[model samples]
Target: MSENTQNAPRPIDIKLHQASRLLEIKFDNNTECMLSCEFLRVYSPSAEVRGHGHGQEVLQVGKEDVNISAILPVGNYAVKLVFTDGHDTGLYSWDYLYDLARNYESLWIEYLGKLSAAGHTRKNLS
Candidate 1:
């Protein structure tokens, strides 16, 4: 195998648990992560969320109850997640997904901090 191929992380399985609002992904490198739908929605890589450049990320609010409506494959390298709120632009690459999984805790903490800084409180879905 080429060096790039050997080092690149790839998903072996991806499952969306609607009831739990979690997306479970298992990678070929033996890493397994369960990411919340809200997290994914808030951290969407689309321009609408990420913006066109640095320091332009739009703070996502009211996504505590958001869920994945669909997962569409993007070639062999990524998947496009269609969110219930009508967001379907981000193409989540394998590397990006792996990074999200591995850094979930810290990233979530950062997100919470941002929310708090913006004076936004999270409301749980009833």
Candidate 2:
């Protein structure tokens, strides 16, 4: 857990904008990452989304139209996401969120490239 914590980054502020499908996050430890809702949805930490155990990630599909239904706080370091698709299990920690935010550009581009390579279409997250 300590190693995981150490690898995770820390964010000072996190904002979820449903209107533009954007999750804007700022880290006091010196970084900022503006991530898209679709990006977060596809990269969700839930077992349903990620699969059980390590190296078993299941590629998410049709998340192009997914949205966050609600954001619930979890203790001092986590946030629970209730997706519009009714998924509400993943507990996204502040550190995890920070990492996601910090790596958004690279990850987003990767996601786009992967989608394109797979001939998949992200039809706007509603």
How many steric clashes between backbone atoms does each model show? 0, 0
Model 2, C-alpha of 49: deviation from truth (Å) = 1.5
Per-residue lDDT of candidate 2, residues 1-126 (tens digit): 121666466666878888877777777767876776778888888888778987787677687767787888888778898888887888888866876766777878887887888888777533
* TM-score of every candidate relative to the true structure: 0.93, 0.80
Worst 10 residues of 1 by lDDT: 1-10
Query: Which candidate leads the pack in TM-score?
Result: 1
- Model 1 steric clash pairs: none
Stretches of candidate 2 off by over 4 Å are 1-3, 7-9, 124-126
